[model samples]
Target: RSYPTTTDEEDPDSNLNATCPEYFRWIHEDLRPWAYTGITLDMVERAKATANFRLVVLNGTAYLEQYQKAFQTRDVFTLWGILQLLRKYPGKLPDLDLMFDCVDWPVIKSIDYGGPNATTPPPLFRYCKDNETLDIVFPDWSFWGWPEIRVKSWVPLLNDLMEGNQRMGWDEREPHAYWKGNPEVAETRQDLLKCNVSDQQDWGARVFAQDWKKESKAGYKTSNLADQCVHRFKIYVEGSAWSVSEKYILACDSVTLLVQPRYFDFFTRSLKPLQHYWPIKPNDKCRSIKHAVDWGNTHQQE
Candidate 1:
């Protein structure tokens, strides 16, 4: 998480020589549509329908034009994330204004803007987007911390998970694939719970329902993200549009049983199906999950 900084004493070019990561290509891809016709104020105004707020960054200072309040502290943390970016790279970001929506589903459908007589696509920033959408994707607010859930920031939480992983070798971990999250938010997640071990069937998966209210009452001991790496495989399924649990599931030092996702975040485009995770079929979720776990149980070296 440490960033390389250039001081007046050192040549700025020294740090510039390092190549940008490949995942940065997505940023270019997101903005490519507007590259030809630049973002106009009119285009910005067009996005107001779905935007929770308009963020204007001019001369290193930021201003917010709130249209509607987002759920909980989403807008607050989202703006905080932007301010952190402005602070991390001072005097580097250009003067710009953009619309931000904190909703789960992306609204700017490609079908709407792809017709021959269609108007220019309005630029919008959101948490996640599908391939059929034109919305620019950004990292979720949980990157800073999910305070309500008592989850720490990304770097420290990742360090804690790594330490937890070291305590138990992958081979020594539980043979069953594991998943624990709220199933009520999406039917897909509710369907996943059916794959769990039962008297009639054992799907090689262990799934638990996350009771945030109960967890909060218990001081979040059983719900700690760092302590959930006890299994050799972990499941990640999208809730609503996309869940913020993808990174955490991948960080567990275990094979990931990733349910096929319709929406993607800023960095998930770089993940390969078989290379990064075992893709679980949405239609045949139970059987697909069982197959992935069985494959992992047999192919331990992979």
Candidate 2:
């Protein structure tokens, strides 16, 4: 478990802190003959080899907005999720690429938005032109299109919300939450509506509604869950689950999503909805989400 140490007795922590800036400045600053030492042909070869799992990191809200699951824009914490995956598979994954929409670039790089802090554009995106290049399929990254009304971060707090719902005398014994995609989008919204939810109380639990469609730029009312007496979520997401990635947004929030695990690999997490991995259809030519998750997780544990 231990790594080899250098006998040079300089304080490792302080030395690293002191030298890293110099090293970075030397690499980034101009007027250097050998500035490209870190990058080489072997790295390129390795990166190409890793292209099988192309990792596309978004610079900010804009890149994700393209897919229609605007929920991806809210929090910066999701970046750590990518780092965790990379740590799990160091060499197997292609080098992470950074990309942002042409419009958001200025705002992201602007000084007012903590231009120098982590919010600033990631350097890797600048170097690597390939981003949002991963072909993997993933949907339902969260419960609702909106992260704010989605799953509470802490598990205990989540239980509280559920308990509160129960205390309100709304089917405390068997409570159910429903997650629906865009009314217009296919594979998610339309199919979500297909699932029968007519009964007020189905399977002994009260049925709740979840929508993942986003509010139009023209502005739309937030989730009407507050107005409703029932305990449900207001997820405003729309578009193709495979194409738009709203389904994975639902999965990210520990919501019990309803979907035929079509493209779950790219966003599979601990808390996911109904998974229909392989056998995606009667003519299913799909792989098992459980298998892929296990495979990825096995490598991570190893």
The estimated TM-scores of all candidates read 0.93, 0.31
Count of backbone collisions within predicted model 2: 29
Top TM-score prediction, candidate number? 1
Per-residue CA lDDT of model 2 for 1-302, tens digit only, reads 12222234443345434544322332333112113344444533333322212235332211221222223443233433444444444343444343222111111122322333522122212111111222212222232133454433334434554544454443222233334334564444444343333554222112224343354432445443322224222122233323233333332332222334332222332222334221212121112222332343344322
Count backbone clashes in candidate 1: 0
lDDT scores for all predictions?
0.88, 0.31
Question: How would you encode candidate 1's per-residue C-alpha lDDT over 225-262 as one tens digit per residue?
Answer: 88989999999999998999999999998999899999
Q: In model 1, which runs have C-alpha deviations exceeding 4 angstroms? A: 1-17
Q: Which portions of model 2 miss their true places by more than 4 Å? A: 1-177, 197-239, 242-257, 265-302
Q: What is the lDDT of residue 232 in candidate 2?
A: 23
